[model samples]
Each structure stands twice: as C-alpha cells, then as structure tokens.
Target: MSIARNVPFETTLQVRDTCLCLHTQRAARALARRFDEALRPVGLTSGQFSLLNALNRPEPPSIGAVAQLLAMDRTTLTAALKPLEREGLVAVAADPGDRRSRLLRLTGRGQEVLASAVPIWRDLHAAIEAGLPASGPDNLRGALAALSQPALR
Candidate 1:
C-alpha cells in the first residue's frame, strides 16, 4: 500500500511518437490489412501467401531453416504449415539426412496457386512503390533489414 506514481501524458506521447517498435508494428498491421484485402480474390491472406512463397524452392528447405528465414519460431512455423498441409498445398517430409528433421515443399497445387498470386503481388507491390517518395521503398527496406538483424536483439 505504498505510493502510486502517475505517469505524465508527455511520456506516453513521446513513446507513441518515437518508439521504433510501435511504429513498425503499426506499419506492419496496415500493410497486412492492405495485402489481405488485395489478395482476397486469390483466397489467401498475406501470411499464407508469404508462407507458400517461402516453400517455393528448387530444393525443399528444412523446418529450422524456414523458421529462421521467416523470423518465426519452429513451433509457430509448424502450426502455420498445418492449414497449408491440410489443403494439400504443401507437403512436409522427413529429411533423408536427419529423420528427426522435416523439410517443406510446395505441392503442385501450391505452385499453381502461388503463380496466380504472383501477378497480384507484383501489382500491389508496384502500387505501393509508386505511392512512396523517390527511394522511399528501398530506404524503408534497408532500414527494416537493419532493424531485423539478430545483433539488435
């Protein structure tokens, strides 16, 4: 039952205005919504599109490798794969080298769906780029990549 200190509104305002995490999270949410709407016709959310795209590789990638690439934990990646697997869009196979490890590959239907989504993605991406100022997209990408570096964590 000690004293309760009240935080000044100025501090809250400062954080809202200056926090990089807050800004990035807000931007991500907005971008996700935009992509979701744009991709609705293709029957995919932005996350699904990304996950499927990640599986599109010549050689199947291991679960751990994909998790690292997507910046998601193995558990989250596994959970995310379930729907795609159920839809027969992706297949998970036990790695020959390591039975304990699983590799992810896009099924034939997955390739077809991803191919369909590509033009939609390209159009939206170009629109986004056009809306940005000169070099804005590149600068933003560089900044995001820098922020995502493991060292920052």
Candidate 2:
C-alpha cells in the first residue's frame, strides 16, 4: 500500500548517489554542526552568528536588505531576530526613510560577542580549508557562489 513500494531500489540509490541538492544539504548540515559546536562557548549557533554578523555594519540595514543578504524571507528574518533582541544583542527599529520597514543593527553586546566569535570562526575556517581536497576551498566557494545566484536556479 505504500507509494514507495512502486519505486525501484535502483532509483533510490541513483538519487542518493547523484542528487546535488541532497549532497549539498548533507554537507551544509555537517558544516552547521561543526560551527555550532565551535560557537557554543560564545552562546551562538551558526545561524545566529551569521545573523549577528550581518547586522554589524556601519549603517543599520533594512529588514528587506538583511533578509536578501541572509537568503531568508522577511518573516523568517524577523522571527530569528526576536531572541537576539530580547538578549540585548540586536536592535530593530522602524526605518525613518520608510515607515513600514525595519532597520537592524548589532548592539554593543552583540559586537562583543561577534568579536569573540571572529577568531573561532577564522581558526575553524582555516582548518576546514586545510582539510579540503587539492581542488581547494576557492573552487568550492566559487561553485557554491554560482549555485547561490537566483538566475541559475
């Protein structure tokens, strides 16, 4: 009665072996785990670190801008900011230029946390690159960047 019963085992194996999305997702999850572990002492997850890092700009970015930079939807970005805001690590205020839009900035506490995170990130990043294949990290980064472009999708 299961729909999976209709599909051949070979098809499943093929997808497992050849699917770029599946491989990328697995790799992304593994990388996130590593970064999460590394950042635990600083009390940030990989996603939170990224969100906080994005907000560490001279000019507070609009919610729309930050969402685009983070490859997230406005709603998801807003949701993610809640905990950081409550912790006094981030501030969200209505944009003066546009009443409906919100601007995001890293608070002084957020800067301190981010400063603590940078060296950890750099060390881990260097270690990861050093362990990568001879094709090297640059090639891997280039490929990921190309894949990130919406037009390619």
Candidate 3:
C-alpha cells in the first residue's frame, strides 16, 4: 500500500510540457549527445571540445576567467582540466602576475585536435540551425544568453 501525494497528475503533466528548466535541460542533453557522437572520432566529448575551444585564445587566460565563461565553478573546472592536462593537451600554470592564480592554455596537440573538430562542429551546427522551428537559432541563442546573464539573478 502506497500513500499518494496531494498533487494531481495534471500538475505533473503541465510541468513536463511547460517548465522552462526541464525543457532547457532536455534540449541541452540532446544537443550534447549529438555533438558527443560527432566528436567521438576525435576522442572528445562535447564538454571537452568546448573547454579546449575556450582556451584557444592568443594569450592564456586565468582559471577564474575561463570558469566564468564556461559557467562552471573553479573546483569543477579544475577537475575537468585534469584529463586534458594528463593527455598533454592543456597546460595549467601559475599566473606570473598573480602567483596564487592559475592560467590555462591549449598545447600544440590540443590546437591540432580543436582544428580538426572545427569543421565537424561547423557542419553539425549548421544542420541543427537549419532544422530548427520558426523561432530560429538566433532567437534561441538570444533567449539562452538572456537567461544566462548574471543580472537575471
């Protein structure tokens, strides 16, 4: 014998269909799966590709800076970097300007991997955008950007 909650099944249906967080999470996971499949040939998950891409700048960026851009916490970012570092794809060093701070950069091999991944990313991105409904990719990106803004909190 099980006790039933006060909430009705209709409430669950409503949330399943209309909740922004649920929809966003579902969509994000789907996109990640597609990218991960596409990037597998290069031995990267979508998250790893994104991390390596972020470090492809002219100058090395601080860990805090990259963490902010990636919308991840410092500890999480550090954990994510471990595999890349072990593979000799990313180098993390103390920032000369601030010894306590760490800076991140892609190694030569990382750049080569990212370079190969770019065309794959471009093709899939184009296909995804082209297949979107009337709201379009730009509008979707704008909405996501707006929601991601710190001011929203």
> lDDT winner among the candidates?
3
* Candidate 3 per-residue lDDT over residues 11-38, each given as its tens digit: 9999999999999999999999999999
Off by over 4 Å in 1: 1-3
User: Which is superior by lDDT, 2 or 3?
Assistant: 3
lDDT tens readout by residue for model 2, 47-119 = 9999999998889999999999988999999899999999999999999988888899999999999999999
Clashes of 3: 0
Candidate 3 global TM-score: 0.94
Model 1 lDDT per residue over 1-153, tens place: 989999999999999999999999999999999999988997888999999999888899999989998899999999999999999899999999999999999999999988999899999999998999998999999999998879843
RMSD of 2: 2.1
Query: Would you list the rank order by lDDT, best first?
Result: 3, 1, 2
Query: In model 1, what lDDT does residue 104 have?
Result: 95
**Highest TM-score scorer:** 1
lDDT of 2 at 13: 100
Candidate 3 Cα misplacement greater than 4 A, ranges: 1-5, 151-153
Candidate 2 displacement at residue 136 in angstroms: 2.2
**TM per model?**
0.96, 0.94, 0.94
